[model samples]
Target: MSETETIYDQIEIEDFTFDPDTQLFTYPCPCGDRFQISIYDLQDGENIAVCPSCSLMCEIIFDEIDLQEYLDQIS
Candidate 1:
C-alpha cells in the first residue's frame, strides 16, 4: 500500500513573496474562506496568520512555498 502524503508534503506554493534581500517569506492570505492568514518569518515563528472563522492557518515551511500562494493558484 502506498502511504498517504501529509499536508506539508503535498501543499506547495508558487510565486511566493520571498524577499531575497530580507530573506523572508510573505503570505498575504492562505485561507479558502473569507478568513485569511498572513505568515512571515515562518522558521522564526515570529509571524503566523490563523483564521478562527475557518480554522485555517498559514503554517508555511521556511524552505517551502508559502501556503497562500498554493491556495491562490488552486482557487
Candidate 2:
C-alpha cells in the first residue's frame, strides 16, 4: 500500500499559481520544483498540494464557497 503523505505547511490558497488555461494550481516547493493541484481536485474537496520532485506536500487553506466564487471570477 502507498504511504500517506504528510503536509509540510498549511499555506493560504492565494500563495498558489492558478492557471486559467489548465485550471491547475501550483506552488513553489523548497526543492525548486512546484507543488500542484487541479481545479477539479478543489471542487472535489482535495486541498493537498503535492510536489512532483520530492516527498513534500502542503495544505491549501480555502473555503469551498469562496473557492468556487474565485474560480467563477477567473473563468
Q: Any idea what lDDT model 2 has?
A: 0.85
Task: Give lDDT: candidate 2, residue 2.
Answer: 41
lDDT by residue (tens digit), candidate 1, 1-75: 114422222123343455444444444444443222233344334333344554444433335444454335434
How does residue 51 of candidate 1 score in lDDT? 45
Model 1's number of clashes is 0
For candidate 2, write residues 11-63 as lDDT tens digits. 88888888877888899999999999988888898888889999999889998
**Per-model TM-score versus the true fold:** 0.28, 0.84
RMSD from true fold, candidate 1: 10.6
lDDT of each: 0.39, 0.85
Candidate 2 Cα errors over 4 Å, as ranges: 1-4, 73-75
